[model samples]
Target chain A: MAPPPLAALHSLGFPAKRLADLATMAGLSLWQPQAGNAGGRVKPTALRVLVLLGHAWEDQVANTWTEPYTAWIEVAALADHSILELIQRARDTSLYISFTTITANRRDLAGEVLSMIGGRRRLSRDSRDNIELALHEALSNAVLHGNLQLESLSGLSVDALERFSNNLTCRITDPDFANRRIDVICDIIGDAVTIDVVDQGNGFLPKPRPEPQASGRGFDLISVSCQSFRLLDGGRRLSMRFPA
Target chain B: MDYAIDIKEQEALVRLTGRLTFNDHAKLRALIKEMLQNAAKRQILDLANLEFVDSAGIGMLLIAREELSNLDKQFILRKAGGQVKRVLTVAQLGKLITIEE
Candidate 1:
């Protein structure tokens, strides 16, 4: 089957850069499929891009969202087939975002996800703030602890912060650690939004903080913002629900 | 995040603007250290224009409080509104530091 034309993608609300990125990332030749046939036919996964785009386009026309094409493209870059499947099942009711362990990328993804969620629904100010804070904690945990394997809440001293920052910089530059992916799946239904963040790392049990410290308060914040949360996949995954 | 320091008598007023989170750890540490060195009695964090505070930001604020306490100096957070105020309240930081409305 032929991939959708660039015009179709544009009409579907995808910007030129986003469409180009999608084509490159998915290894799809939207304009010249035969020119790239030396590498064989388009990968099946590439076709799913169309399905995903189509879903967003339909949602846009239905007035569910005005502009979701770029966001979908961003998700498509890192999302595995499972995420795509999940999104297909509930495109109008959910959002799925994933990215590598790069700190900036994680922040951008989180920011984009939060913006979309906020724009799509009319959430209370409290609910929006809580979700924003909680999701920040979750993303930080995924990058710093899960993928980078950094120590938590090292120390309150200036020296400690310096050492932590140095170590973090070194870890971020190492491909073995930085290439790992963190996935955020958010399901919004009724007055509740459930967000699940999954990382590719050996997870650890979240221990109770016995004292008020400079670090390790992430769990406390998450607990405060989320209605309920649970660890899954040996702690590699954290799922939290926020109610309106 | 951006911060401005104003030394008024023995008190140093550090006006913080924008989001404070893990990303601003280095800057926050430097700011706190500088405030401690200059402020004779108290270091007041003016968060009137601060829009966001994450858990890490809360943690950093606690760090500032702890360090100031060891110096026998006051670390006061004032004018925090909206999200910053809410996070400070949820983290129960008022028990550890002086939070002035």
Candidate 2:
């Protein structure tokens, strides 16, 4: 029989939505267990694998042991043997690397990503690495929320979108769409192009204070990197203009 | 990853021999949580047999350390070698967690 905690994760995430994103951020997986048990104890390793794979979330790993020592043995044994790949190969700066990850290997997407650099038909190798780094954030967010199926994934989805929140200049200030995992639909008419990205995951929630941890820097990549950007209606939906 | 642990009275020595990574987060987190929950805070994590670490593995370790700290405990990582230590250092997590090489 499966452990009880796994049931909780199933409610949060399943079937997995953004796979490439999860692979980019938070990393693959790991394991943990108690000290020792009598013997033939139930294990929790399988569930963790599911979460890292973007298959599960919120569910705790299951364990069974009268004593603690045996459980730890099982846990440690399972944990001490995995080495994930250091870098991803797909982050090349050829065309627009704009999945839910990068906006433009050429144009700047804003917030935790880089802009698409246009000039030479080819891009220099040095600057291309930054695109990978930037996209890593978006990729991370997409996978993190999507995999966990947490309510926060919604924020990564359409959260933090703020349009004309500042002055009533009809200006928009939504989260950077270039790098984040938003649902974007673009319509091109003559010299004008209309684009929209809709993030499929948990919506936004308030950021909570916590101890020191790495910053989730998806929006930053798009905002700073993108040339001209704007947020619309609490970052729910936004639009950008690029000259042809 | 597999392990052989020796619990002598107050000290529970866990010998971890493998490459900790994403493939094992679930079990590892539960086991570590249980260890911190039921045993002494002064736990020995013997990584002599450890080989490599990924982001998931590192995150698990950090989480364990934090959770243990709440219990006024310390997870002593012993015998972590060459490339393994380098991975921890690059992640900057080495600064927070105890390591012996």
Candidate 3:
């Protein structure tokens, strides 16, 4: 038989005692970087786990383990079971889910939603691909643009994108910005799915893309993939409907 | 994403594996710089092992194409399959880069 969950975490090199303490803390934990370990390294396995959990950032290659780590692991812990329930709820019955999460980017949440919906629905390859791509754009926009309140790339050039990415890394670590919440709601009816990603930051109107450009493609991708999409709450809420 | 580049004659072949998203920006930039320094007449990115790509990845590819075009060096994509191919197609990158079968 497989080892118990806690045992598995221990075998994976997690601090079992710390994990237990955090569990008791009920999804809240304070992390402070250990003294004399400023440049410490994270194990490869732990780094992979953090990436899969969406807790690692793009610019964290060298500093993967350099900073203090704090997380409410309840969401990460539910990967296995939540994945199954997500699909079952969509297939066997109507499914409605609303999740509110801190501003830290949670790409896994979007990945989970897509995987579950794909498993339950018999969508054509094109349709499935479109939905996955569109959903990713939506989630990215919600986190980077909405909650983080960062402007999209000013130009398609490499320099511009690099600057945007660097700014993102710094902004996500700020409590004033990182503490904001992104609300995701998914409603599945029969074979169709509608998802709304709402953010608390000030919203903006999407300008028309008169030509091919680097930024602002999020709206275009969503429009092409879904049957219809509307910007509501002055762009704070993006609701997209994918047809069966 | 992770990449390995092989140089043969005037052409450079790069094999990319793993998800290519915003996370790979720095690595991708360094790789592009390396490709530019090689002074190869042509560069081909092979994506058969690539599993996923996001909008930022697409933009990076465009940047590569534009930079190469400025140097009059040929840049092409090869062997993209599965989701990677789908995303490339959706982004209409074929209008700017050569995709080889």
DockQ of each: 0.73, 0.02, 0.30
Better of 2 and 3 by DockQ: 3
- i-RMS for every candidate: 1.4, 10.8, 1.9
Model 1 residue A105 CA deviation (Å) reads 5.3
- Rank all candidate structures by their DockQ, best first, as comma-separated numbers: 1, 3, 2
Between candidates 1 and 3, the DockQ winner: 1
What TM-score against the true chain A does chain A of each candidate get? 0.66, 0.27, 0.58
Q: Would you estimate the TM-scores of all the predictions?
A: 0.76, 0.36, 0.69
Residue A84, candidate 2: how far off, in angstroms?
Answer: 32
Q: Reference contacts recovered by each candidate, as fractions?
A: 0.72, 0.00, 0.28
In Å, what is the interface RMSD of model 1?
1.4
Clashing pairs in 3: none
- DockQ, candidate 3, vs. native dimer: 0.30
Best by DockQ: 1
Question: What is the RMSD of candidate 1?
Answer: 8.7
TM-scores, chain B, all models: 0.96, 0.85, 0.97
lDDT against the true structure, per candidate, is 0.68, 0.38, 0.63
- Candidate 1 structure lDDT: 0.68
Encode model 1's per-residue lDDT on B1-101: one tens digit a residue. Answer: 99998887988888999888788888988897897788468889999999998877887887787788889998899999998888888888989888999
Candidate 2 at B82: error in angstroms? Answer: 4.6
